[model samples]
Target: MTRHLPARTCRDCGRNRPNHGRGLCRGCWLRQWRATNGRYDVATGTGMGGPGIPKTAADIAARLEDYAFLRALNVRRLDIAARLGVSYRTLNRYDARLRQQQDTA
Candidate 1:
């Protein structure tokens, strides 16, 4: 028989319920993992940007998917690309895509 753990608020999702204190329940956390494709962890905050910061290619993809505002936000694309471990040309592509998306939406 499985033991029932106590409930708690998820620090990440901020939902009240039976959470195991990884700040999220197994299901929500699993969904988050799927969001990250199990390669990166935005929760523990690991990536190229720094400690608890996600900036790698995979991480960038995940962040872009989750936060459209980030795409529209005015930022130095070169700098962003430098930090993201990608080239300026690639950054331009991303920017173009974002602009197209923003324009359409």
Candidate 2:
């Protein structure tokens, strides 16, 4: 006979959804992951200043240079994202920003 286990609630949101991991629901878990990961501006499609991320204009310029260099080397976008410690979507945003900057310059 199989034993029934008690239902678990999310520790962070106190929701009745199924636990994902660390006693958090899926939404809570994803929020936590994003918070701990790199900073990103969803609406603006830009990287936000935070720990271990580019903040100043010079820093952003340096990152763009690195990204351009990687592209020149024909590195796969996914590989570049991994090397830069950012998500693929964020890398796409960076690419767009780079293009915009190039167009204006």
By lDDT, the best candidate is 2
Looking at model 1, report the run of 10 residues with the lowest lDDT sum: 38-47
TM-score of 1: 0.32
Candidate 1 backbone collisions, by pair: 45-52
lDDT of 1 by residue, 12-82 (tens): 77777677646797678877766655232222223333454335888767645533444457556544554
Every model: Cα RMSD to truth: 13.1, 7.2
- In Å, residue 65's CA in model 1 sits off its true spot by 5.6
Q: Tens digits of per-residue lDDT for model 2 on 17-62? A: 7777799888999988876775433322234443454479887677
Candidate 2: RMSD to truth: 7.2
- Misplaced by over 4 Å in model 2 are 1-54
The lDDT of model 2 is: 0.72
